[model samples]
Target chain A: MSLTRLAIKSLLLRPARTLLTIVSVAASVAVLFSLLSFNSGYQEGLQKQMQQMGVHLMVVPIGCPYEAASLVLEGGEIENYLNESVAEEIAGMEGVAIAAPSLMHAIVRPEDGRTDIYLGVDEKHLELKNWWRLNDGEKPGPGLLSEDDAVLLGWDAALIEKREAIGERIWVPEIESEFSVTGILEPTGTQDDGFFYVPLRTAQEQFGLEGKITAVQVRLTDPSMAAEVADALDARFAGVEIIRMEELLGSMTALMDSARALIFAIVAVVIAISGVGVLNTMLMSVFERTREIGVLRATGAGRLHIFSLVWTETLALTVIGGVTGLGLAAVAARGVEAVIKRFVPMAPQEAMTRFDPHAALICVLAILGVGLVAGIYPSLRAAQIRTIEALRSE
Target chain B: MAIRNLWRSYERGSETVHALAEFDLTVQPGEMVGIVGRSGSGKTTLLNQIGCLDRPTTGQVIIAGTDVTALPERELVAFRRDHIGFIFQLFYLLPTLSVAENVGMPMLFARAHDRERVRAICERVGLADQMTALPGSLDGGDMQRVAIARALVNDPALLLADEPTGRLERQARDEVLDIFDDLRADGLAIVMATHDLEQAARCGRVIELRDGRRLEHAYEDSWPKAHCAT
Candidate 1:
């Protein structure tokens, strides 16, 4: 019978208390895991989204910058647009490498109630989006759209509306018109993978807005001069908002930083409470076994032995709880991700509830540390007991 | 084992209580020394010093030819582990462990891992049939027997028992005394503290204590009775 066995047996003697303590510690650990993983996933998702967009500056009508960015970058309802002439003006600006304009509209098919995104762009828009590749069929020619009504389907759109999409016309109930699919765009693993593309002039004609557009995506010749160029453009276009990509990234990072701080605070409180719970349980055990400890001492056992018994019991409880909590976190994270996707369709398609090995290791080490600290006071109390005094205790 | 001028005192608030003062005694191998005293007579204090469970405020306790009183706590613990065993008045068996597990505790502490010795000692104490039973299921006499088995499991040279049969019936008390006699016959030293004058008279030497000091006429010629068959 090692001290470990003795400790385990002691805990088993009071099975109810032992189980309750384990559950308490496990609940705290699960909360910590969930919060930490969410923070990591949220930050990683935002960074990927920003990096994949591949634009330095966005020019949008005043008060519609957010709505325009959400539509182009996340694919959703849009009720705003800029004049088509704004794209030409921005293209002729100094230090501007490419100024691509696009118009975004969504139509719901009555047959399935599924919404489809229609993004109208000029020939320069394709060149500006360097990641876009033609998977099959034909690429559009270099010009604004004409009366031909040719369209290119996004990878996801092509898959959903397969066969009927290629070399066949798909009806748009909103506009009461039909357009021929000329090509299929390859999967870019971005917001663009779920949209349909048509020439800018065709969208303008179909929508009865001959000179209107949605937003202008600007690529700078020198990326470092983005702030200066954006300021110059902001001054020239008083009715538009010129947002630098770096500024947008910085604001998003700041928002996530605040969220991370709140989560970290919550984790700290939970760890502290669990630590106290461990201490309370061990102290109660010691109090109940005071005379038993005295007997052990009288029978050639030492203070170190008493200390080890109490500490071992605490460690066993915490370790079991921590492992169970981690397993629960892994399972709960998947459900949480699903709930987030159901409510927010624009959420990152990649897993947003990540539990990497590094995070898991840190969580385990931290819980063990809590166990050690929590066990200290009770173990010390056990070690300091006088054999005669303890035996004399009723 | 010998004690020399051992004194133990405590400060209870503003008053000082001297539990033991100038306590001195000696016992040879195969000796059964009984300590007789009233409630505040310091017999328990003497046993504590000799067992190395506590340090005396003043004086020396020499066990196995070493001054255990002078040894540090760490060394004293190891010394106790190798040489001494103790049986208590209440028979403080762990309620959770089986009789065998309770008896095996001393060997476990010694890291001996000798299952045979534990079984042999349990059998010697007549608890072989109750090896797998928890202490709660055992009677007072059986519980005391388990404590005795635990004490002897480590095969220590000295055993200190405080009121070993205090809670047992007359028949059970006689059984415990018989076991003590058998232990003494096997060349192991034994020290017992008891209020039972009949049990004290059966020892090779009896020491009486009062006001933390030894009485001169503790042993008498008439103490040994014909009915005592040790």
Candidate 2:
């Protein structure tokens, strides 16, 4: 039999201790794997969310720009509003291609245990959101919501409202408005899939916020002219703050990176603790097998052989733990993502716990590194055992 | 194999206790020798020296012409691995390994493991049916047989057994002695330490020790001869 097989068999001799040690390692590795996968998934999801927004800058009423941006991207009622005239003024600028004014209002129904978000927009808003596709083969653009009471339902909004086909009527109890569903947007895997679209004037009048919009999503004809356009808007608009999308993305990513740093520290501590558990288990095994090691020495095993045998057992423990941890992480990704969203601010609507093979590889390598480090002392102790003394040990 | 002026001492607190002192022995190929001594009489110590498991305090253990005491630790290990084998009284077989694994352990360390040779040796030791069984599942006799099989797996020139049959029943002890007889007939030299006088008489020559010194040197034909030495 090979040293590796013998080492594995030795671990099997104390099944409970071996299993407990492996489980501790697996617990740490699972956390590490989930952290790595979240890191990759969060970064990618944030970038995708930004790209799907299809706007170079957002002009909102002076407040916390990040909170205002979050409220606009994810549908929520804003505490402040920008003048509706800002959209027309921005559209008249040289570099600005489209300035889509929007009024977002959320009606929280505690009894229903849900919040209904209403987004008010005109044709220019649709022009900026060119990626929106309508079900029932209808084109989503300027005339989609031409009627005063016409509403465009997002994929999830239609499903929740049970209004999938065109010409379906929906009654809004909070706003006391009855509207016809002219079109339903297909699923876009974003926050947009959960919003109800209405005409800007209708939403303003019905919500008693006439002549006011929450934000204006601006797309520039020349992307490189973003700084010039933002500076011009800052000078022109006294009550509105211009938030560049790139700066917003950088801020969000930096926030996530800080959170990730703290989590990585925690994971590191956990891994270190698990490494100690491995060392302890191996040390106990070595201590218990003194006479057996002596017998091996008597049968011609050198110090190196003893060292390798013990070290190989340690590696086996970690490898099994690492693989089991990976599987556990994969199965629990959804639950972990939900927990992350609860703690992390501005979490993207897209999933943030996707599987990444590179992350898995890094976790495996890290486990091996832990195994190597943890194996050293125990293996050395086993190897340094004097044959005569060991053989005489009870 | 020859041992010259072998001395083994241990420091207990402020006192130095000699386990084996000024001992000398010479055994020829194909000869079976027994070392008889009571508790604390250095029988195990002498076997440890012969097996290269322990070093002499100040002496030479020349096995197959190489003075093992002079060899470096690494080369000494190689020398022991290639030329010497040992069987312990307690039959310290690894519980994790099966009988076959235990038997092939020496060959595994020597980097010359051969499955067929391991099987042949197991069969020779009458452990052919118990090859796949773990040591914990085997009786004392079967366990000792596995230990014996492991010692012989390397095909060593000198086999040092410390109370090989000390833990076995009468029937098993006789069976082990018969195996030793077959091994000696095959030209393999053996040195065994035992407390049983009856068992010691089965050897070609027997050396008796007391207080780390030789008490007598007896032969099977002569029955016993008193040869006391310090």
Report the number of the highest-DockQ candidate: 2
**Top TM-score: which candidate number?**
2
In candidate 2 chain B, what residue range of length 10 has the lowest lDDT sum? Answer: B221-230
What would the per-residue lDDT of candidate 1 be over residues B6-104, giving only the tens digit for each residue? 899999999998888888888899999998889889888888888988788999889889999788888888788888989988998988899999999
Against the true two-chain complex, what DockQ does each candidate achieve? 0.58, 0.71
Residue A282 lDDT, candidate 2, scale 0-100: 95
lDDT at residue B188 of model 2 (Cα atoms) = 96
**Residues forming the 10-long window of minimal summed lDDT in candidate 1 chain A:** A137-146
Tens digit per residue, CA lDDT, model 1, A32-119: 8876776678778877776667688989777756565555444354455578888999999999989999887766555776677777
Candidate 2: lDDT of A269? 93
For model 1, the stretches where C-alpha displacement exceeds 4 angstroms are A51-119, A122-147, A152-196, A200-244, A334-351, B10-17, B218-230
Which candidate comes out best when scored by lDDT?
A: 2
